[model samples]
Target: MTSFMEDYFRTALSKELAIAPPERDHEHLSSTSRLLEKQREVTEAETLLANQKE
Candidate 1:
């Protein structure tokens, strides 16, 4: 009985969480690219600021 309940709960939980559109690869790549671009910009600004202070 416990095994049966475990299987039932597992199935229900899986179904409840199986709720994504699965287009995450493309979305994630774009998000990563945007973040990397922003990081590069910030690094450039920091270098310029240090150069001016020196």
Candidate 2:
């Protein structure tokens, strides 16, 4: 589940990065990228915690 979320967010980040200059907002883009990365990390940690309980 965590790996899946990480992959999905990475794909989304790539798509967002591919936009042309005139269509992109650098600040918003950077914030979104950072947020996605953080979310991915949290998901991975949660998955690890869950697995350790088994």
Candidate 3:
């Protein structure tokens, strides 16, 4: 590869890594999962109710 291409890739990668946030901790991940599950359950219940009216 040319020097320009290598420099471009390195700069782009560094910028992307810098812009991205760190990974969440275990507890945070579980909390998010629980909230998402609850949201799904609520959506399912709402859909059932809506369908029953049909």
Candidate 4:
């Protein structure tokens, strides 16, 4: 689980690094995608942890 979180963080960081300077709508879309990805990672991690508790 720790490894999974670490991987997700790394991927997010890479994506952020690769993002070019926002020019127009692309900027908004990129930001939104990143936010959604992060949210999904958090949700998945929480679910995994919860399952472990049971």
Candidate 5:
């Protein structure tokens, strides 16, 4: 009975937390590129601020 209850709970949790498949690889790549662009902009801004302080 204990083993049966454990299996039931395991199955229920598995279904509840199932991972969804990625819909599109292109969308992921574009988002990653955008993130990199934002990081570059931030670095440039920091450099400009440091130079102005000197």
Candidate 6:
């Protein structure tokens, strides 16, 4: 209600928004999913090769 309170609230909200992580857009999520899937595949392949060595 007062000017000081309004300014304080605005500053706090700005700081929080700055510290928060960016929203997960579809493209970003898709790329991340693809990367994880590739990593999993590589690990599985490495495991299979190691087993074959035994």
User: Which residue pairs in candidate 3 collide?
Assistant: none
1-54 in candidate 5: lDDT tens per residue? 997898688668866886654454455577777687668669867965774574
Question: Which residue pairs come into collision in candidate 2?
Answer: none
lDDT of 1 by residue, 1-54 (tens): 997898688668866875443333445578777687668669867965774574
Q: Candidate 4, clashing residue pairs?
A: none
lDDT (10s digit) by residue, model 6, range 1-54: 697797687668755765433444546567777687668669867965774574
Per lDDT, the best of the predicted structures is 5
Alpha carbon lDDT of residue 28, candidate 2?
Answer: 65
List residue ranges in candidate 2 displaced over 4 A: 1-29
Instruction: Work out how many backbone clashes candidate 5 has.
Output: 0
Q: Scored by Cα lDDT, where does model 1 land? A: 0.67
Flag clash pairs in model 5. none
Clashing pairs in 1: none
TM-score, one value per model: 0.47, 0.46, 0.46, 0.46, 0.46, 0.46
Query: Which candidate would rank higher by TM-score, 3 or 4?
Result: 4
Candidate 4 lDDT tens digits, 1-54: 998998788668756775443444535567778787668669877965775674
For candidate 2, the clash count comes to 0
Task: Write the residue-wise lDDT of candidate 3 on 1-54 in tens digits.
Answer: 687797688668755765333444547567777687668669867965774574
In model 4, the Cα lDDT at residue 15 comes to: 61
Per-residue CA lDDT of model 2 for 1-54, tens digit only, reads 998898788668856875332444546667777687668669877965775574
TM-score of 2: 0.46
Model 6 misplaced regions, further than 4 Å? 1-29
Better of 2 and 6 by lDDT: 2
